[model samples]
Target chain A: MAVSDRSASHLGEAVGLSDEQLIEMYRLVALTRALDERMWVLNRAGRIPFVISGQGHEGAQVAITWPLRKQHDWVAPFYRSIATCLTFGMSPRDILTAQYATANDPSSGGRQMPGHYGSREHNLVSVSSPVATQLLHAIGIALAAKVRGTDQVAMTFMGEGSSNQGDVHEGLNFAAIHKLPFVFVVENNGYAISVPSAKELAVEDVASRAGGYGMPGLVVDGSDVLECYRVATEAVDRARSGGGPTLIEAKVTRLTAHSSDDQQTKYRSEEELASEKARDPLPRFRAQLVDAGILTDHVEQRLGADIKAVVDDATQYAESQPDPDPSTAMRWVYAEEWPSEAPPPWGFGTAGGHAEEH
Target chain B: MPAKTFIEAIREGMADEMRHDGSIIVLGEDVGKKGGVFLATDGLWAEFGDDRVIDTPLTESQIIGTSIGAAINGLRPVAEIQFADFIHPAFNQLVSEAARLRYRSNNGYSCPMVVRAPYGGGVHGALYHSQSVEAFFTHVPGLKVVIPSTPYDAKGLLRSSIRDDDPVLFFEHKKMYRSVRGEVPDGEYAVPLGRAAVTRAGTQLTVIGYGLMAHYALEAAERVADDGISAEVIDLRTLRPLDKESVLDSVRKTGKCLVVYEDNRFGGYGAEVAAIVAEEAFDYLDGPVTRMAGPDVPGVLQPRPRGLVHDQPGEDRRRDPD
Candidate 1:
């Protein structure tokens, strides 16, 4: 119930979570980290096209979504929302399929770049490459929920860089004016692509801008999983209880460069990179579980082994899956099978005809 | 059945659909209490209340972006961009998000929302309010661009756009909103998109146009008929899927073609029609297809002597191609 500082307690029990829930949270964090590691390898080996690392971000991403009801509450995720998407019922195989852009990839059938995640079955909105677009979408979903009296909270994620987009301001102002049941979280991982926070945000914290939009804003330590869970749960509860929208700035650390193509070393200082290690949430969360006697050396080894095996199986399954059918490349331009008005001559409504400008 | 103005028919279409289906909600600046800037959504707020008829803050992107979200989730939201000139702010939401929702998601999701904006110049709404931007959107695939010429087509196409399972941009001409009128049936009727109607059939040449231009083309066709120049006028109800057959059939019958539009002549929507005719019906064409469009100006005007509405002081009655 308290808005804790960056040095707040990270204990799962301190947040009233059970030992089993703590262990499950740890497993999810480790799995996301391992899968992200595999994606970088796949990118380097010319197997996959790109990689958007979710390394230092695992804890906050995983914990903030702990209270959300899977397939009931809606989520509008950004590209770096691997842990959040996984927490929302996206499997390890689902991540790999999206990474590989295979025929069965639910996010997009090899159409979009890697890290774009969405699943209607899981109540996740489609993740577009453009940042801050999802903020408006979450606001919209929240508006729909409020209108229907669905008692559901809509949550969305963005980065410090994306917070400056015009859409973010518009979405925040709209949600605030309407008092929509929405939660907007900005995962400030120090830098956006290569632009640091200072260059992106003129203010000290991105949360400070929330005042302009008339919403309650707070900052959270992204590495402290339990604290983030407490904060996000309160925000979601507030939204569902007609308290309107809230903005959260999760101060995470980007463990890797922006993507496979970006080189953070070109701009980031060695000292800054060193500082990110101590803020790495995965190892921090792991050590906390160990210090609490919730996980022993044997259990830790088993957990690591289990995550490695799952990542390996997902990678192999996705690698062997067929690429999106080349012949069906231009499908779903207009909601396929909506009963066309008997398309005109020159095969107007056919796959090739309708895609004249596709 | 009674005759109604284009704007009245549009209001009727939305009101009737909202009565039949509760999911349909209207959201935009002045769309609710103010009944829209042009009164297109007049009286919707009183009937549907604030929940169904929402008056949003003055932001086009939020108006459209939220509608896309609401559409994909459950509600059938009808977002209005106060004017066509102001629609540029939400171009990304429409082109990138709504247009690509189904394709980018690989049919995993679809944005079944309608973004209605009054377009074209006629009421002396200079510069910011008088721009025609249909060509800007018609070029984008996965989006249906419709401009109705008559009240009857407006109501039918309104229902079709509401029921269609994809994003539709419905542009109503400001000049024709109150000026144009036609009988709309009291019962149910829906005009399917991607089709065109030949308002006037002739054999000399095919005049292809949509929106207010379609009505002008029909009048021009009738006038030229008295001069022994038989002209066929084709009203392109839907511009994206574009009744290619109707235009081609007319062009093949009449050896010549002329496309008219109110947008900029340099890159007007009529150019696409001209291109399509040249590409497919090249052999059938007796001569090169031509385009009659607005001059390459920043905005459309009522020509000089602005206040002259039907023979004013010192105003020339004769009209020339500007």
Candidate 2:
């Protein structure tokens, strides 16, 4: 399919999501929070080695991804994108398997550390430990879409810290120059590991740099699910319609420390922490749904219990799964086979074992 | 077949592949209009359009990062890093990303890309332009490092590297680019990634080297032939996934080996090759494996005027069985 001729009506009134879609998105966000909390407990109990919680950024991640064409659009998610990945297609079991580093983990097959997520079915490009690299990878995916004449758009998430990376600039410039179907979402959750956003950039907002790349810059209230969804829907529609890339700065809160290893209280004051807590997207979103009568207290209670059960079952199942064999660890280091003769018409089979259709 | 310089051979190799495979793309600083600083990518832009032969920003990270991304997305991207010395900025992409992509993704994705850079000294490039960067990548497990000594090998190895499923670091010596000429076949052909060539046959001692050092080793062998010492010269075209069979066979026949390389003597690529011989063919050795390499110093401080350079390993290619 080529760029759609659909009008602005594609972005309907009142954030444009049906009740079912809204509830689904809320369920994903709640499940993500539940799983992230379980990971912390597992890490503390010495069951799982590490955990990178996606607690505070869930609202922005879930809202932005809710409008995406799940298996069609590609997502190169950052480490702090549990809610995002879950919203895309990753099941709770798949996520917990990754955290457990089990053989069943589709992302890395238990090879990589927890939080590195990928799946072809979900159209999520695998990422590395290095920050900002995935943005260029996403740009490449978009380039592929542009070259192949497909309507597929690519998006990647990054922390405010990764905005300072050189790859980020290159990715943005390349995407703008090529007019590729892409979107860059900077989830500005204040601090990157320990360094604050003030130290990361001179500008007040990360979106301010978009003008230099000749793309539209957007600043969204990340805590407001409807606001993030509206901005993301517009960006997605624009990108899918051959309108090129858009830089969206999602001003979210980092409710938890950077990871299980970090301590926010050391850097952030009690007053600052309390203020951020008051604006926590989870409870705020729940309250909004309740006041609107879209969600009752009974539904909220049942949903919470259901999400908790799902997270608990996933953690137990993942823990029960076998770890990857150390002897077979060297399997994927090199491709299964190099082209002994001439490669096929597309050169795709020369690597990655599978032969994909052109 | 036609006689071609090392640069022309590389260009021809990439061009031939580009003609055969539509997915192959080239990008780097000035790789499009300028045809690369070394002219290795000459005429590629005119032959292919701007889309295929991309002129990228001077940012090394972008060049490599994009290449890795493109490769993973089904493009065979050969990214040029202008000079080997200027490749540190792209090191993370090459090492942590490109090299590890196939493995880390459990073969779900692969980086079938080539990172070609001009390396070595002798043309007075000094610091930023002159360097032997093979040692840094040789330690990396997933990377295949190729350094060819002749036009024939340069063309063949580069073509194979572009076709290989793994990420290959093709380091063409700057000294050999224009100066080194040899017969390169016109039709498609490729020298495999893990094989070494016995450039010169001899029975006395085996001399091993790669890139320009291998060329110099042949010259040294010719000079030593007059004194009745038949030094078997072996050119290690690919540094990693080393041609252990060729190295062992030559060492077994000659009973001694002397490795020569332009990289610093300490922790050089030559050291690993020397150690391979010591470990695998130790029983067949007649004497200790010796290495004649550049001293452990920065490129700027090295003596100039080529031959006047005091620590030139090409001058030290003698057999010492003791």
Candidate 3:
């Protein structure tokens, strides 16, 4: 059987997921795309500062995120993972609130810049402007889990350009040497800002470098949701089962500019951009659902309408939310209590006495 | 109590902490098997096994970064950087991640780990191996900087650092690893983080210092004592949360103060101490606060530079009855 046929059958066999879960994943992907598009519009309207669109890579993100045990398995995601955050249970309102630097945003309480979302409850690390830094953090988390004898694994996401950074090499080497449970997913979307991957990396396949680190490497079609899910599931399972780390290279296409500040037309030719647009992941995944008799044209149309409504409501709610208080900017610089000088829980000690002196 | 070298006290502190808390682990280059290049972690691998006493690859960034994650995930990790100068590769991890994690996470997470490096000159290790980089970390807010002058303080303060719920940069003087010995308690004990100890009391001048420089300051104080000038010596065990009260108290009583440090004279920790005195106790000063520091440009790159050695600045030199 073909790989798509196998994936379709596997999706049908997976237990505990009702039609609602599948529909929710699809709806989340749609909402993320719409929100990203709206942010681009807002950027033009001077209502938002910046945006990094997650247009084409939504299918693979939604697929992998649907089965994740959020907040349990740590996520060290790259900058282009807005959809992954949403599918993993962050509300659209929260993402929008954070984008607008509102107080209601749980990701950072408006402390961080847009696209640098992190939630303690979600176990999603704060994304930084520096690429590939999260890879080392993921490796560190995985090592901690291994040391603590926890079965949980850390999953790190990155773009193709990040694979060239020294942090990535060190992260993978450390994880592989210690046999730590972790998965590194590289979203290869053909361009890093303006420079093509071919110019940036000597190796055509980023996953092939996994062999040097003594780990299994796999490449899959990122546009196919089911295919991406299957590959990611296998890698995650291998890690959870004590088989060590896996490097997954997801072949994706960038359907938009790198970010609001970027203009892809300046670097990519018109023909190249047109070809990538034609292979957009959303429609391809919907067609696969239709081929499996699980979804029809009417269902897709209804899903699109439902997601658009949700996105509209969330955007309005986010825009209406209050901005963060200026005085609270330095509130979290240190924990409320110093480690050595934490007050007694039951009020046992003298209020201002020097305990260390006695 | 037993007399112990600074290196041995550090090893004992780690062993004691590891024995007490299962969550505490050690990792560094040659820390295990080799027992560390300075033997500060000697016998730890044999005692705690390979799992707890880990020997990491020569990647300083990974060593420091992973320790941050480990500490955040409910493990107390003590990471050694081998030498102070080599910590540059891991500077970003320390400054950005470890130092800022608690602040950025709004107390939801913390990096309660210790980064121990043998710092300062006098061992002839030269450029890469010998450096006093405490000032760099002292400038960082969330990180607590500690420099111990003796074995007792080294062990007790290290134990405190391992238990600290914040990132601490612990500097162990390489020259003092064997040369400096002191009575350290056999039982479990800890030295408070932000307190200074007065090694000696005098009436004329207060000699304020830390790490190996504290020992030098004491030697200079004793030399001055023979000339009948009473010099008070204060050892600042903790650089951050600097026992400013104790420093100010000594400076207030003596009316004259001399801050000494081995770091380069330009922008050194002595400047910070001087700034504090100038800011807090400017009216109490009888004369200008003197500072003795290593000269700029790596101090001539050779020992005993002719005419390079200088005495403490100001008019107090003539007051001695030598």
Candidate 4:
């Protein structure tokens, strides 16, 4: 369990992962990348509204979620967590439906902007557009878990830039104080929108802030899935054992610009972008599987083809799904028959005539 | 029925609900041991213990944010923001997370939480302590803003808000907490949301108001009754999805409307009431829809005479047609 930096080793074997599970991880990473690519095309062709790619971070996103119990554990994900959501059981069609803003979108039914993920079936909490707000939500759910005396642990992910938000500090401090079962993971991709990590964080490691809340802080190389899986497993175990929260910073690389409208050329230098591309986790992880003899060029070709087919099918299915009816705009604002006391002249008589006995 | 103060009514209502429903919890600064700044949550910590009546850190965002999470996880959380003015720190949590949780999640999740804060400016508590923030929350579509003027209404409305499916911003007027008293029902009951109560009935002019202004409107109705002017007072219990039918009916009967609020006159909740009346009941109106509200300035910081900061709705009734 030595933390190796970007080098391929037999660490995946040491983690006791089966060959099928490891390959599935690679497939998910590739599928997430391919789906993100499809979204860019859809956005460019005016078929979709927006696209926020999780490029170069899929390895960390999917790997860190390996040790958790899907549909039992809770995840409060940030916008760029497509791979993580996929690992948590969000269908590809769900992501595509959200991208197309169709009626069948599992998360929001075309209500919110793309990249916002939510799925109750998988225990994934609704993620809003505001940065770092998920940290507090994760803590709150964990608080519920603690109050109920359950071993369920909730995890939240944020960007390096979000670490500077007041919510991150307040949530982490509150979680630590209550000894809540939670994990705060920071995907340090070296940039927040256009601001670099240097400007966003005063300390070198985002995990260093964990000490302020009396939590264990660990930094893992985001490109190495094995290292992230190992750390995430430990953090989850510690939280379930009543050890409180742990702050883990996965140092990752962002291959693409922030969103569809952003252009890295404006703020990020070409050399820096090129260097990050060279260390892209997709190819690096693929190389690791190849060196481990678990994957050959032929298996890689088949996985790539299968992922492309899945993405294509999802794109076509979501694109054909009908858009939400404009008349249903006020559907979820309140529950059905809510504000139970209807305005007068339309009701039996007075406003309180039929007050519910609850 | 028990005659109780507005704050006592609130505490009793929540305690009663918590007794029946194990999921209901109160969390905020001083909500536990200190029993809240104004004791609005008095005896709750002792009854429900620290777990149910939590004492959170002195941060508005943490209280609101955590409440949203708790609400989503099968718990009905009532978060108390110390004062209305201090709610700004949690604006993002309310508007983004709590308010929109249901709509964004497409009914997959809902934040059934109530954020209770004391509002209004009568005790000369100054800018930060005494301010009305209902106008800001009323503009958000997914949120329900409730202001109860009497002890009875406070208990009923708060109980109803706790059972509501959407996020509710309950603004308890600071001046009315102890000053306003009435008989609250002893048995289980809830005042339904999205309805207005006609506190005082009349026929000449319909005076629509909420919170402290509603009390002032009732006084104005009584004073105008001394004259030949029959002033009908409508207490708007819920601000959003505003009991429009009640308002339009009152306006149609009275043929005139006067909307009153404690917030600033410019871009205040009263303006919306006036606009709705003007748009829907314009043909029935005998005169223009008048509005009585606080001046369009930041809340007063210095000590002032009895009613300098807030509008005197009863005095404004003097301008009624002779």
Tens-digit lDDT string for candidate 2 (B87-119): 999888888998898778777788889999988
Task: Report the alpha-carbon TM-score of model 4 versus the true structure.
Answer: 0.93
Judged by DockQ cut-offs, is candidate 2 incorrect, acceptable, medium or high?
acceptable
Better of 1 and 4 by lDDT: 1
Q: Where does model 4 exceed 4 Å of error?
A: A1-10, A297-301, A338-358, B307-322
Clashing pairs in 3: none
Looking at model 1, how many pairs of residues clash? 0
Output the lDDT of residue B73, model 3. 63
**lDDT assessment of candidate 2:** 0.83
The backbone clash count of each candidate, in order, is: 0, 0, 0, 0
Candidate 4 chain A weakest lDDT stretch, 10 residues: A1-10
User: Which lDDT tens digits does candidate 4 get at residues A267-356?
Assistant: 989888888887688888888888887676777788888888899999999989999998777566666554534422224355564321
| Candidate 1 segments whose C-alpha is farther than 4 A from its true place | A1-10, A338-358, B302-322
Over B25-125, each residue of candidate 1 has an lDDT whose tens digit, in order, gives 99999888889888989999999999999988888999999999888779999988888999998989988999998988888999899999988776656
Fraction of native contacts (fnat) of each candidate: 0.69, 0.54, 0.41, 0.63
Candidate 4 CAPRI-style tier: acceptable
Candidate ranking under DockQ, highest first, comes to: 1, 4, 3, 2
* Tens-digit lDDT track of model 3 for B1-322: 8898788899999999999999999999999988998888889999989889899988898888888767756688899998888998888888888887766655656778999998876554555655789899898877889999999999999999888888999998887887778999999889988889999999989899999788878888888888999999999999885777788888988889899988888899999899889777888899998888877765334342323322332222111000
| For every candidate, C-alpha RMSD to the true structure in Å | 4.6, 6.5, 5.9, 5.4
Indicate the residue-level lDDT of A332 in model 1: 80
Query: What is the fraction of true interface contacts found in candidate 4?
Result: 0.63
CA displacement after TM-score superposition, residue B2 of candidate 4 (Å): 2.3
